[model samples]
Target: MAAVDDQTPRAQLTASPDGRVTIPAPLRRAAGIEPGRRLVAYVEDGRVVLEEWEHLLRRVQRRVIAATSGHSGSAADALIADRRAEAAHEDVSADATLAGRGAHGPDPA
Candidate 1:
């Protein structure tokens, strides 16, 4: 366990057999944890981390911005361009096939 600094928030909690750990009112107030608010908990660097829903959302947004920062356009634009190329290829193939069999389309049976 890492040594706790005086400025870091501290609380002693006990978990019940059912695995529920209730946050004390003072700590909850200090942490801005509302009664009905959602939280995301995960282990990081061997320590348990509890993050509020909004905090996680902001963190993910930052990560996405960092990842796509160098791109000139959004990923959706690139996907649309690829789809258009595929559609054009299919159209050319269909035209070639139609030309081979005449405009009447494939012969019956």
Candidate 2:
């Protein structure tokens, strides 16, 4: 086991020739990674990052399914629809107010 200091950036250890790298207990505990935990590895800025793979994939798949089924619309679409309805209501109210303006006499103090 490698000794990691407080300032150590999660020691970058190499896998054995057999393609196996033991995860440091401290790092695993901090990341909530444990035995039977699935992980995804990717390189960013020349360094490899390991993340909880199954959880991320499940979240992405759920979003994709929702979008494909049209059960969930994007935030922008919902906002635009709401704004359009509000504008339509405002226009109707303005038209009504203008048409009734002459019927109401000058504002009585």
Please give the clash total of every predicted structure, in order: 0, 0
Off by over 4 Å in 2: 1-9, 58-109
Q: Write the per-residue lDDT of candidate 1 for residues 1-109, one digit (tens) a residue.
A: 6786787667889976655578788778877888767666656999666677556656655655565556677789667555655565565455444544444334455
Work out the TM-score per prediction: 0.57, 0.41
What is candidate 2's TM-score against the reference? 0.41
Instruction: Give the top-scoring candidate (TM-score).
Output: 1
Clashes of 1: 0
Candidate 2 local lDDT, residue 61: 53
Which 10 consecutive residues of model 1 have the lowest summed lDDT?
98-107
Question: How do the residues 5-56 of candidate 2 rate in per-residue lDDT, one tens digit apiece?
Answer: 6865475778766555677887787778878665556567896667565564
Clashes of 2: 0
